[model samples]
Target: MDNEFYNAFASPISVTQNALLKNETGTTQKPPKLMDIDDYNGWSERFGNWVEAYHLDAWDHTEVQYFRPLGSDRKPIPIRELSDEEKKKYKNEKLMVSLLQ
Candidate 1:
């Protein structure tokens, strides 16, 4: 599913911490969402002009990225410390007691 999603979008649109309100004084803004654009081809052409105007790359450039795989209510998965010998003797991993039983 993850692979299929990535292949389709070729990019992941992360939820912004703070949405842009307006272009008021001393207010910075992120680019608009794909759905926000009414015209794809027209926007792409204009976007190319924008990139050139700002001296930016025509292609999408990604840097350090992080993704949350679980819901906000979901508890984080725990990691256990292992000894050197224990690390060397890795075995099949069991997730939960129900699965194990």
Candidate 2:
């Protein structure tokens, strides 16, 4: 994957955290499950730390960026006319969402 292409659409922390992940163990802790309101405080803190470790917290500060292919002229290509490669790129965004969820 092109880090430049990926970072172009990502939050600022995405670049730094991703760089760190690449350099480090590249493993993240799973978030603690929330069973009920009673567990909210502890679960929230642990989950927040887990997401932050993986830079998934970027999603909380940024709106979802839908993939938009660029044409040769450098303008965005219509979503309806995506090539197979573009479709694959679009799926990358979905993968990020799945990670956060």
Candidate 3:
């Protein structure tokens, strides 16, 4: 009983530790940052390649349009009620926005 309790508690701590440490596994070089209009062309090409290297399906995420599920009354349906595909798109949209920032 004690072993089970300790394992359950330790699992999350170990996972968090691994997540924090995983950054060291990658190259020290970071993806290109957009500085200004003069650098936009170079930055866009480099950043697009960088994003593609890291995320194979990233372009799909960029191209998809998210249409909110609407109820009969025309109000948006609750997010919790979204279909699995919609939920994935919703999550990807937030991720893309974060990356753009």
**Evaluated with lDDT, which candidate comes out highest?**
3
Worst 10 residues of 3 by lDDT: 21-30
lDDT of 1 by residue, 2-30 (tens): 99877565533322222322211112222
TM-score per candidate: 0.23, 0.33, 0.59
TM-score of 1: 0.23
lDDT of prediction 2: 0.61
TM-score of 2: 0.33
Q: List candidate 1 stretches off by more than 4 Å.
A: 1-33, 36-38, 57-101
* Better candidate by lDDT, 1 or 2: 2
What overall lDDT goes with each candidate model? 0.33, 0.61, 0.67
Residue 60 of model 1 has an lDDT of: 22
lDDT of 3 at 37: 75
Quote model 3's TM-score. Answer: 0.59
Name the 10 consecutive residues with the lowest summed lDDT in model 2: 22-31
lDDT of 3 by residue, 6-88 (tens): 88768888878665544323233445566567967877786677666765354457776666778999999888999888887
